[model samples]
Target: MKKTKIIEIKGLCVRYNNISILKDIDLDIEEGAFLAIIGPNGAGKSTLIKAILGLIKGYKGQIRIMGTPLSSFKDWDMIGYVPQKAAHIDRIFPITAYEVVGLGLKRGIRGNNAARYINNVLSRVGMEGYADKKVYNMSGGEQQKIFIAKAIVNNPRILFLDEPTTGVDIKAQDAFYELLKSLNIEGMTIVMVTHDIAIVNKYVRQVACLNKTLIFHGDHDEFCSSQNAIELLMGEHHLIAHRH
Candidate 1:
């Protein structure tokens, strides 16, 4: 079986106030890929995802999504994103999980069918009984689940998550990754940015290391076996560990 490249980038560079954040980077994301982007803070991991998703503008390069240039691409519903710090969503504001997921529903889907779809998405994320639960009252992990449900309720082909498990408990992180794994198994492409190197090997099919530029891009097995890649990650001060 062969996978098609759904995302293609060439000479991608991003800058702010004359300061370069990323430079001359090229990346291709195939359909159904589970890729992990890892780097130190401010290494442009989030910027890269934002750039690819067309959230940030004025970058020097070409990006094509689903074979259409990003400048001409308009099918946003095909892409989903969970931004960093989403776990800390306004604890003081009262909003139910069902309403949260509804935010992602397409304008055309409504009435009973929309209601059932939202509930089904909630169940898929293991937040089934939480459809009516207040996000402010739920645990950090549970709130994260609601956000994921919102991201996926649109039935996007590829999902992007930035630091999805930050500030989550270990137990919750395990469950969260398991949910992501199941989603990937069910044929959803996922691109995630994480500071956790352990997760790079634990769940990702591809590993891309970044630092103002692409330092490495390869399969997880190659990353684990290459001393140069290991040393490069060590320079970033990320703990390197092998998963059994």
Candidate 2:
């Protein structure tokens, strides 16, 4: 039995003003797959995700989420997104961690049910005990976990994370990846955009290298073994057994 495709992109193209951001992009994400989109800065990786999320307008080509065209897909709740650092979060805002996660619950899960749902997600990320903690007091990693809890509080089938470990410490990053791996094992589709090469080789099952177009898209091992990937990502240096 073949796996179902959770996301499908065909001939996708995006432009801002008059310059092209992405051109002729094609990719597929299978159900339960952990896909990492990696590339140098300004490579249109973020643009691709925004296009799929319908955050960008006037994009050419097709994007389908769970077999439904982007324009026709009405199941926004089924998809969850954890943006980098919750970029707009004001550290001094004085909101509780639970309240932050609660914002993800746009509909349903009211009252006790809502609290229970939020608690469950927080617990999954190992931040349950900090439910009442002020967001500003938490470390960068702790705050990132809170963001993850918020993204998953709604029980989304597919989760998208952008630069999830950007400011996290090494220990916190390890724990974070473990949580994500557990979620993927339990049947959640994960699409993460990152510049972290180490985590890419360790956690993601699929790799998609983008530089205004699809440079490579296949298994992790295949990507690691490819000369093109090594050149594009690691520069002129050969990939050593361990990257310091």
Candidate 3:
């Protein structure tokens, strides 16, 4: 049997002040699949993510989340998002890691249950003992893990991460990817926007190479084999690898 598509985008286009940012992009992401979107800066990679998240306006296209039209989809809790690391958070907010994760809980969770849930996710991210530590007192890797724990505290079906490993240490990056892969294996669909092409290829099952458009979308092996993939990555961006 074929897998179900969790996300669908067709004829998608986004423009900013008359300048095209994403042009006629099309993509299909299956349930439980791990997909990585890669491209250089200003390549509209983030724009495409915003469009799928329904954060972009005046776009020309159709987007469906879990087979429902984007505009009509109201199951926000089914999807989770972790934006660029610490983009909207203050390191010195004085909030504990447990408190940060607790904020994403949906209504109705009792205090005891909420704390258990928070600790469970923190443990999943290998921060089991740091629950009481202040957010600012933690290292960058520790902080990123807490942020990820916050995003998944509610048990979302699909998780979207943008530059998730930005400030993480090299060792933590491996552990982080392992954590993501383990989650994917346990049936959580992951869509990540990353610049680390080489690292992503080692984990994600699919790849979507974007540069103001959908240049390539396919399985990891095919993406690694395609000459177009190398050309597109090497053509304008030195950030991506020439070979997987």
Candidate 4:
């Protein structure tokens, strides 16, 4: 049986101040698929994500989620977003790890069940014991895990991460990837924008290459093996040497 499409984008174009950033982009992401969008800097990768998240308002395209038009999906609660940085969070916010995770339940904060959900999400991310610790005191990797816990606290069906593993140590990167794999296994569709080609090739089921255009979107094996994809993402010099 074919999986239902979770995300559908067609003729997507993004522009800023009359300058084009993304042109004629189109993509269809399957339900429960782990997808990675990869490209070199200035490839409009971030712009693409912003467009999908509805952060960029003047985009020209049709975007749909779960068979409903983007405009119709009023309850964004179905989507979980973990930005590249915890931008709004203050280093010394005086909030514990548990409270941070609980923020994920923003829309469901009517009663005590929000706390229970926070605990469950923290445990899933293996940060159960750190619930009482202060966010500012934790290491970078730990902070990232806490953010992930917060993102999933609402049990969203679709999760989007932007440069999730950036600035983390090697060990932390591996652990985070493992955790993402586990989450994917548990049936959450993941859309990640990352520059880590090796990790993307190893784990992502699909790849979408963006650079002011929809260069390619398909199976991971084909993307990793394609000459064009390699050149587009790694640059022509690296691709030539990599193939040789």
TM-score for each model:
0.95, 0.94, 0.93, 0.92
List the global CA lDDT of all models: 0.88, 0.87, 0.87, 0.83
lDDT of 1: 0.88
User: Over all chains combined, what TM-score does candidate 4 have?
Assistant: 0.92
How are the candidates ranked when ordered by TM-score, highest leading?
A: 1, 2, 3, 4
lDDT of 2 by residue, 1-244 (tens): 9999999999999989989999999999999999999888899987888898999999999999999999999998889998755735676688999999999986877999998898898998998689999888888888899999988887788999998898898998999999999989989999999988878867888889999999999988888777677778876234323322
Off by over 4 Å in 3: 235-244
Better of 1 and 4 by lDDT: 1
> Tens-digit lDDT track for model 4 on 1-244?
9999998999998878898999988899999999998877888888877777788887898998888888777767778889877524577588999888877786747567776888888988889899999988888778888999988888889999989877789988888889888889989999999888777766788889887887888888777577677777665225222211
Clashing pairs in 3: none
lDDT value, residue 131 of candidate 1: 83
For model 2, give the 10-residue run with minimal summed lDDT.
235-244
The RMSD of every model to the true structure, in order and in angstroms, is 1.5, 2.2, 2.1, 2.7
Q: Quote model 1's TM-score.
A: 0.95
Checking candidate 4 for backbone clashes, the offending pairs are: none
The TM-score of candidate 2 is 0.94
